[model samples]
Target: MNKRTDIISDHVISALGDGSEENFKKLLNNRSGITFHKSGKYSDNTLPLGAIEEELISQRVNGNRLPEGYTRFEKLCILSISEALKGIDIDITSEDTLLVLSTTKGNIDLIENPEMHHKLDLWYSANRIASYFRTKNTPKVISNACISGVSALLYAQWHLKEGNYNHAVVVGADIISKFVVSGFESFMSLSPDICKPFDMRRDGLTLGEAAATIVLSTERKGRVGIVKGATANDANHISGPSRTGEGLYQAIKHTLDDDRQIDFISAHGTATPYNDDMESKAFKRSGLESTTVNGFKAYVGHTLGAAGIVEVIYSVWSMYENMIIKTFGYDEFGVAEKINIADRNIKKELKNVLKTASGFGGCNAAILLKKNE
Candidate 1:
């Protein structure tokens, strides 16, 4: 029997050109994507966010040869996966390669326009991308609220360990629409400006859309490796996390206990009061209070279902560059926990890192990764 290691061969992260480098120097220097759209009915009180440059999307699609009828989510997924696999000289045979897609609302925009309602089918979205790449294996789609992206990675790890597949492509995407905007507005979760995580003035989340993809395999070469991973549910609350953050704390403890030298942590700091407070409690309970922690929501806003995978890409890239990216809008820590919130860029040699996330239904997941030598 061969021992298996969770190895990430390559990864591609898609963000608005403006939110990324080149057009903007860094996240801290760019204007927030949150804006008011007072033309629509919900616009009176709701703020709509649109970040990606249309021309950039066009360029990516043309370069990747994506189909014209593909929805925004599909196009983003195809582009990110294509880029992530570029120059990778791996032979993926039929039945050996798998594709897992994670999204909260797949093609939900099609439903808004009755003429395109039929195009919103989840199977079609999954198969279209698989067929485009000429993969004979059927793709798997997971829509587990906000944790869908991280769950996809967990599923891939299990299947690889079981020898069901040799490699897997995990992609996550979700686009903003009237449906998503209005729903969050109804819940009073949308902030009028960019989100400020762990701040006394924090209000709500700023919605953003993105697609991030990563290639995972049992083979480890020229890639970062997943050292450990664990998932748990509080079973204590239906719509919110347990006040004590029991599930999150357990997930963190499980990941760290296996390897105690985890240097950095990428927190799911959505900037929402309750979520941020619960995560702060979890960090303290896990005894990782001294570890450097940071949030990426300020840079890309909260990408709903795509947050897990997108943040994973950021964490890996930060390690690769040997720099810890700043938590753009963080100002203060309001929690009672003694946490090290990273408010400035720091250069450090990171050996192992932990990425933690929690979602609706009290679902929590934590993954540990080691930088490749």
Candidate 2:
């Protein structure tokens, strides 16, 4: 047993709304933030996307206007971290505090534009965000494909347990760009309409953009905190996940250890045929085929690097509210394995919840959040 890493405060900025509560409220109402996009910004064809309005970003930030010279990506991160830091007692300037940034593509949209090549670097963007808050330490950045959010949280927890830092502000953000959209389009992975996770009509994933932040400390600052986390790679194809679900299962097995009684699971249900099927197989392999599971993608539209942190924040809200939100677009159990996918809101006591993520390069991550005793 190690010192527990507890979440202090958290925030989420998505198409649903600003704060975690706002987004959770929409979930309770079965409202989705996904919208149809016909703009030529992402692609030539119309696509479904979960993008935050520029006006919202510009208006909700600290100054009601984005700071000069800061890219949209940087501003979104700052806004999320700033909201999470509101009224908290943590001294971000203290050397005992660390900042960790998680994003698959940080300022990657600047690649095509000139005179900002340095801003294209993830570290540069991370430092900019940290400097905005006057943090003393050089920020750590994680860019592990789609699992960056969970990976960043795991890194913070490991360092906190080791007494390297007293507090860590982990923020994950990613915005959809022409470059990113075109890459996914090349693979034909984007859904033409709202995604259907684990549903028979599911075809492809809907891309999304968002920034989510979570503050963690060794002390119990909140009612829920991370208990354990693990990661495993199955050495599968670059874009395709393991069909047997061995990687995700191994990660789940290691994360749960002796405690297999998970109240529910926040799955990485991308709505793609392979991802949902693999996750189902993994749940079956872990003997958790009966645990209620739900995917947040239907609401947030697969927010790339932010998916892990965003979904984690939503899961925390579920624990606090003691309600499991339904899989938004799932009306049928379409996965190959017979897993219990939550199609309706479930009001049950949640003491422990499992959050799982799988990404490119055969990466899989699982983290357990337990109600503080």
Those runs of model 1 whose alpha carbons end farther than 4 Å from true positions after fitting are 1-13, 18-42, 46-50, 91-93
Candidate 2 has which clashing residue pairs, if any? none
95, model 1: CA deviation in Å? 2.3
Please give the CA lDDT of all the candidate structures.
Answer: 0.75, 0.91
- Candidate 2, residues 285-335, lDDT tens digits: the string is 999999999999989898988999999999999999899999998987899
Candidates' TM-scores? 0.91, 0.98
lDDT of model number 2: 0.91
Estimate the TM-score for candidate 1.
0.91
- Minimum summed lDDT over a 10-residue window in model 2 is located at 58-67
Model 1: per-residue Cα lDDT over 1-373, one tens digit each: 2435545544433444522233123443534444455646334564646445567778888877776878887887788778767767544436788898888887887776898887688777888888778886889988777777777887887788788888888888887777887788887887787788777677888877777777788864645766667888988987777788888898888777845676899998888888888888898888788889988887767787778887777777677766777776788777557688887887888878899988888988898878866
lDDT, candidate 2, at 95: 90
